[model samples]
Target: MKYFIYAVITIVGIAVIAGFFIVGSPGLQRLRRLDETRISDLQSIQSEVIFYWQSKEKLPAKLEDLTDQVRGYKAPSDPETNLSYEYEIKGEKTFALCANFSLSLGPEGNNAAIPIPARGYSKPGFAEVNWNWEHTEGRSCFERTIDADYFPLIKDQKTP
Candidate 1:
């Protein structure tokens, strides 16, 4: 009887540990899914921008242009947060895309890079998570390289 009791206790303890791990596993997995979705959404926006620029001469001043005016498309927000993504207009040819400031869950504010797939005019690029205006070398404060012919979609209007 004593051996039976000890075995039962061991089983309960093991079950508790297993339960914790099992419950915790999904949280980690959810975070990874969120990150990937955010990255993929950003990449999709970049590709859409490339497509828009190809059909037109400049990038839309805002994201809604895709949903409202552009044909066969609409901008997608993050699935987890349901918030519109943010885009920084750097110049006539380059821009930066990110989740809204509040959507970033990273402690150090470094979001992952959207992989630049070798298709269409969308080249892979990275973004910093802050608004620091410093001109650090190799650490673009708010600048990006726009190399493709479709890059001009992001250009801002110049006043005469």
Candidate 2:
């Protein structure tokens, strides 16, 4: 009876640990997917803005500028926190884009931040702009970095 009781206790402990990992995995995957999606969307917008600016010699200041020319056009925002995407234009050829992203791993207090290069959200007819995460700063899983080829002066845009 004693041996049986010990075995049962060990099994229960193992099960509990397994359960935590099982439940947490999906959440982490979702966050990663969300980050990737945001990056892709930003990249698409960036290309459109670059083309538009090259032709017009002026950058747009809002997402609406790309609506008529850009298909499936919808401004991307932070899904988890319901925050707006950020934009800032530098000079005539450079811009910045940012978003407040959420992570499932909670705040890792990671001193390092990941940069999303040549990626940003922009509406057609808008100027090149800079973006950065806001609201849940510590919880953000992604950061912004401009591609030197696209925006030679792209610099780190800090979010409030």
Candidate 3:
């Protein structure tokens, strides 16, 4: 009877440990999902900003400036917090995009582990460029500069 009791207690202890992880996993997964969404959202906004500079020959004064119906692009808000991503004009050809991230950039918890994919422009001789958008578990910002020599001609369109 004592042996049976010990076995039951051991099994119960193991079950509790397993249960802790099983219950904790969803929250971790949710955080990772939110981080991924933030990365993707920033990437999209980066692309649109580059396009806007190429077409307009000027940095957008605000995030709202990129939302023209003719461009068919809308700035994205945070997936989890529902807050608008932050944008700031740094200079004539420089700007910054900011977001809140829920997870560290990588398994090692180092910012350098985060990979910012190279974005390619449609223009000739303007090779793919990396924006170096890296983040940690809270708020992070990325700065970008448009090369003046590579500006593409702006397309004329009626404002909607």
lDDT of every model, 2 decimals:
0.56, 0.56, 0.76
Give the C-alpha lDDT of model 1: 0.56
Models 1 onward score TM values of 0.54, 0.49, 0.70
Clashing pairs in 3: none
lDDT of candidate 2 at residue 39, scale 0 to 100: 59
Q: 1 or 2, which is superior by lDDT?
A: 1
Could you give candidate 1's per-residue lDDT for residues 120-149 as a string of tens digits?
Answer: 333336332222222211212233445554
Better of 2 and 3 by TM-score: 3
lDDT (10s digit) by residue, model 2, range 23-67? 545665576567656656666666666655654556777766766
Among the numbered candidates, top TM-score falls to 3
**Positional deviation of residue 66's Cα in model 2 after best superposition, in angstroms:** 1.7
lDDT of 3 by residue, 40-132 (tens): 888898878878887877878888888979767889999987988999989888889999887667545643343545454555556655555
**Candidate rank order under TM-score:** 3, 1, 2
- Candidate 2 worst ten-residue window by lDDT: 103-112
TM-score of 2: 0.49
RMSD per candidate (Å) reads 9.5, 10.3, 5.9
Top lDDT prediction, candidate number: 3
Model 1: weakest 10-residue lDDT segment is: 132-141
